[model samples]
Target chain A: MSLLWRNVFGQKTGDDSLAGFLGSIPLFAEMKPRDLRQLAALVHPRDYDDKETVFSEGDPGSGLYLIRNGRVKIFTRDSSGHEHEIAVLEAGDFFGETTLVSPAVRTASARTLEKSQLVGFFRADLLDCMEKNPRLALRLLFGLTRAMSERLHLADRELKRLHHALHELQAEGQD
Target chain B: MAESNGLTRGHVLLFFLVMTASIASGLAIFSSASRITELLHTATTGIVLPVLLALVLSFLLEPLVRLFERGPLTRTASIFLVFALVASGLYLAFSWLSPHWAEMWFSLRTDLPRYLGRGIALLKEAQARVQEIFPYIGGFDLPSRGRVLAERLFSHILAQTTGSALKIGGLMVLVPLFTFFFLRDGQKIVRASVGLVPNRYYEMAHDLAWLISRQLSQFVRGRITEAAIVGLVVGVGLSVTDIRYAPLLALFAGITNLVPYIGPIVGMIPGILIAMVDLGIGAQFWWIVVVYLLIAQVIVDNFILIPILISHVSNLHPLWVIIAIIMGGKLYGVLGMIIGVPVASILKIVIIEIRYYRQTFALPLGEFDS
Candidate 1:
């Protein structure tokens, strides 16, 4: 795609398309004008099929991923085989930024709700970004934390649900 | 973030301060191994024990905590119930084990010397006959340096841990106390933490906490499950093989397996070494090891651990895990390596949170108000 086209739109913005919406994604927000201009040099697009897991719960968290279009559902399964959906991250929502600092096993599995387009960064690229723009790196943390908070809430709910189920079972015999 | 909640210039300054502090501390700690040991020991004694207890408590007591939160117990009562359960379990286990352990100890003291003498004689005779069976096996002989090697390893660990000159007991009680408050006022703590940030950065803080907790929980819980499975598999396998000290070896395997990346290796070393050195069946021992490690690798790390962890964890690459393990080990030795993954993952979430905060606060500050 042409530079302006990709820039204005998702990757490059042409005049008529959805190019103007590029500013919202936290990943691209902190780029310098010159850097943003040069992004056309580096940006590559990836495609994922619907219901296909882009990443699993314990995959290598090597890098960050940007969801340019479509939706992703991040969920966790408990020991008793209960699966709890944590978040429905939509476009402009950036995921997987936790890989750079703690590329430990993944905490949740991510799968596409639909065919999706994403841009990703490996550890080296992220470190480079941190080196050049530390503020930008911090912003990435914020976005990642949002996703995490969502999951914590889910864990809290899960704990509560287990309690509720047990209580209901106990009351059932009494009733 | 809405333009209404733009970050002021002070917010920008605070950002600079945090970044500099994190970077400076990183550099300082990186400069000295001794300092790193001090740092690590500080955390292990301080944070690790409470976090571990809290985690186990959370798991074991979640049901009770919920009951207390809901009805007559309320949240605090539920906490008490959880404690009650924990205390009961500990009491039961100790009572159960104490009588047997005392008996074992008395018998062990009495019989070990005699067993050693007999074992030595058998080994000596076996060594003489080994040459007749296979010339190459006869030359290898028993390891003479085993005691020295063990003493060295223990001394090395002691030097780092004790040499730091830090009074471990007096150093810090913040971890347990902090963990206590965390368990009690986790909500308030999170709120107060997130509340410090201006409204502009709230989303980031929220997200970061979510991600960090999830990753930490997944890793910790997975390791627990992984350890249990490894211990069970190895314990069962050895018992089935008619290996001596099956229970002890199994316990050792389970405990060591918590060290991840290096865990299985640490667990295997003693098992394999025992088989080779004492059993006197080198080829068979080596074959047993291959089969043992392969099965363990499949059942625990691969089939069991990966699935359980991945269900809720951020997909992390194995290379990164190894790197984290190495860095953690280098920084804090065993404890660091043990806690490395979750800590590292949490830090990543924090970093991401910091970034999102700047965006919410910074971008709006620069924008011209309508």
Candidate 2:
């Protein structure tokens, strides 16, 4: 009875579309239908208070957090506690994986700029489940890898922009 | 700012790894060095483990610390509150186990003798069988080098084990005691560690260090929480089944399982043997043993332990797991074996971060295929 509601539940209308969209994700393309269903159960849509931290950059992190609605910012804080924006995460975006892959502190903090909703999947929990369902695990692995790769791609772009801005500022100062 | 000297994150990481390896390899290969040097890898980990665990525990309990930090309670009182919680948990755990273990001991005193006799008879019969098959092995007479080897190995093991236990008891006071100080002055430590960085990448490295520290702490916190839950579940299950030594068996299972991969099996052996002894011989006993272990495994693996663990420690590879155990075992023996996997995972992350630093700094250009 405790698990009755959980075992055979259906997502609300918008939530169903979100699940559908996740299925369409190249990262999750490998996940089987049943496995996806299992994952869908855990992917609760959660809202954050504005300026509320989803996770801090230096805080211990596990699982990947995906923006389901609204926006979150990834920013790293210096030792002096100065925050630096790393990326703006919107619907369909994910973060917090660098910690999962490397066991390092998050490189940046994730704060809700607007009222935000995110769905999360902890790596440890999912992997354990994956053992029983390797096909789904493989799909998740693909998704995790892609998720990480996407963040790095974004960080790289940011770094390039910083470099260009620095050069421009240097030229301007000389003039 | 001029025509620049750029260090890529790749270059930084390579230099860091190569340098660290060079130092480590030197120490590992040093023949004339103290036996202590051989344990440096493990001994170093012993120090890091307490500090890291303390930091993580502090972080997880930050809300409580912050709550008390704002309250009428003094810093010392707040710390005492934390320690009291830990102490009570330990006390309650021990209290529950004491009676169960007493029962086990009483039963063990009676039953172990029979099991040993059975084992001895089996060994003697096997020896006789081997005598018929291979004369030389049997020819090695009574009180030969075998006894000496066994005796020496056992005595050495006993001495080392006792020494390690004593050392652990003596020093584990530092873990919670330091944890209290860490929770209180953690910011000071972070500031100091950050201060050591130079003007160049000072900001970046500080961010990274804090992040790294946070990640490691979360992993430990999550593991501890998950382990406790598993232990509680196991204890309840055993109690429900009317199994003997439920507390002791669950305690062992819970604590041993703090170590990944190797722990469950390690914890199970003692419990299985205890169960075997408790049953006092019969097919029914064996069936109970099989079922308890099976159900316990299912609940712990499927529902609890693995799910939580994999979520936190997805960074560690199987190769690293084995290597860490071996390396830890070689150094501090069992403790090293226990702490080695998580430490290795953390270190692996550090290595990757160093690599990330190199690429960011333009320290050197190398293939990214790795």
Candidate 3:
């Protein structure tokens, strides 16, 4: 009877449980255990075969996915139609966080490098959570905002470095 | 170029075959609709209606359960608490309203024949006036025609009423049991069902299910709320005017109001008929009742309750709404009419999302990989 209850409610308590894994994610690190459990209930766990396309460039993105196991390659195509590998993400890495805040097209494609497990937390789920549990929704939105801010700062530094390199190249041409 | 031309021709042929198959299937289904409806109706009445009703109940009660869960209660505790509260509330409401309801029912039983006679006479008088205007038109036996029509209508209504009463009695036991299970294990059920989708479409399917469920929940909750408010307002308005059987008429109004566009007008008929019969057609009180019903059902309900509760829930075109209601009435009667709009809305969402997903994700990994 207890086993049935646990299975139905997903009340498994341990580091291996979905709520535990969700809690360990940096984005959800500050959330309460109860909130984490509630959020876990809304997520979908999926398995992908090797070389499976998760999403393609220009596809409408709807959610953030946390890698549970195996590796995923994020890449994009230039005008010349050459694939540029952006990052190879392993288990525990999360992507597609931007779509949580607004509807957007994926600027890059994601494909699995090996047999992989992923947990998706969609915008629809977030919106529903906002309606039912605004406090939990606020915590999630705050976490997403912080993560995006950090990424923006990193992008800013990279852009400054590229600008400096371009300046040096122009000076050399002038000489 | 030759190979590309062959590939294009093959694609065109495939498309043609698919379209032809689709059209043929659609025609077959349309032709066999009556048989399908019979099968569906039997299945629905036997077991499915209870489950469907329970599902709707669970959806309506979910927010309250969630609210309870926000406190110190576990989900199981919350569900039980909600059940207890609902049961108690129903008990109280029944106890308080039963006497008034009984009186109204008794009055309606006694007065129904007179009202019918008056209504038929009014119709006959109008027919005579029309014939007088058009002398070429021949007279028919109005009383016999009216009697036959009334008999048929009443018998049908009685059959439906008896069936519904039996279902409602069964529902007393089944609904709570089903609702409890649904509330307790709904997430697990959804997860297990979604788990069946192949990996290629898993995310899209998951998102679609969530989106659809949210829309359905919003729509069901909104419509019920709108109905309750409209019913209460009409009841109060009628009571203020001291109309006969106001509670019964209000209940009728509330139930009919679930069907969009045609419902409010249908709801107004019983009240107007009662007023006309009791107070005579030219009585000032009859006009007052007409004005009050118009205000309650039309001006207040359409302007206030619908915009507030249901406007954002469904954005169906008026033409589609009418067509859905008519088709629903044709297929499943009153239940069909009530559910038609939401079902149509769900189909619209499914088509749009499927098309969007297909457009966005049709490109194969091999195309890029190669």
Candidate closest to the true structure, highest DockQ: 3
State each model's CA lDDT, in order: 0.60, 0.65, 0.81
**Model 1, which residues run further than 4 Å from truth?**
A1-175, B1-64, B99-147, B154-179, B282-291, B311-319, B348-370
In terms of lDDT, the poorest run of 10 residues in model 1 chain B is B361-370
Please write out the lDDT profile of model 3 over residues B103-178, one tens digit for every residue.
8776776677777888888888887888889867756777669867876776676577768788789888898999
Error of 3 at B286 (Å): 4.3
lDDT of 3 by residue, A50-139 (tens): 998888787667888999899999999889988899999999999988877787777888999999999888887888778777899999
Candidate 3 — which residues are off by over 4 angstroms? Answer: A1-15, A31-39, A133-135, B1-41, B139-143, B155-165, B282-289, B312-323, B345-370
What TM value does the first chain of each candidate achieve? Answer: 0.60, 0.70, 0.88
- Model 2 Cα shift for residue B151 (angstroms): 7.7
Q: How many residue pairs clash in each candidate?
A: 51, 24, 0
Q: Give the number of the best model, judged by lDDT.
A: 3
Candidate 2, residues B187-276, lDDT tens digits: the string is 657756765653223335554665566566666766677667667766776665545667767777877767767777777765555555
Alpha carbon deviation, residue B292, candidate 1 (Å): 3.5
List, for all models, the DockQ compared with the true complex.
0.01, 0.02, 0.32
Q: Give the chain B TM-score for each candidate.
A: 0.62, 0.65, 0.79
Better of 1 and 3 by lDDT: 3
- Candidate 2's TM-score: 0.49
Error of model 2, residue A125, in angstroms:
29
What is the model-wide C-alpha lDDT for candidate 2? 0.65
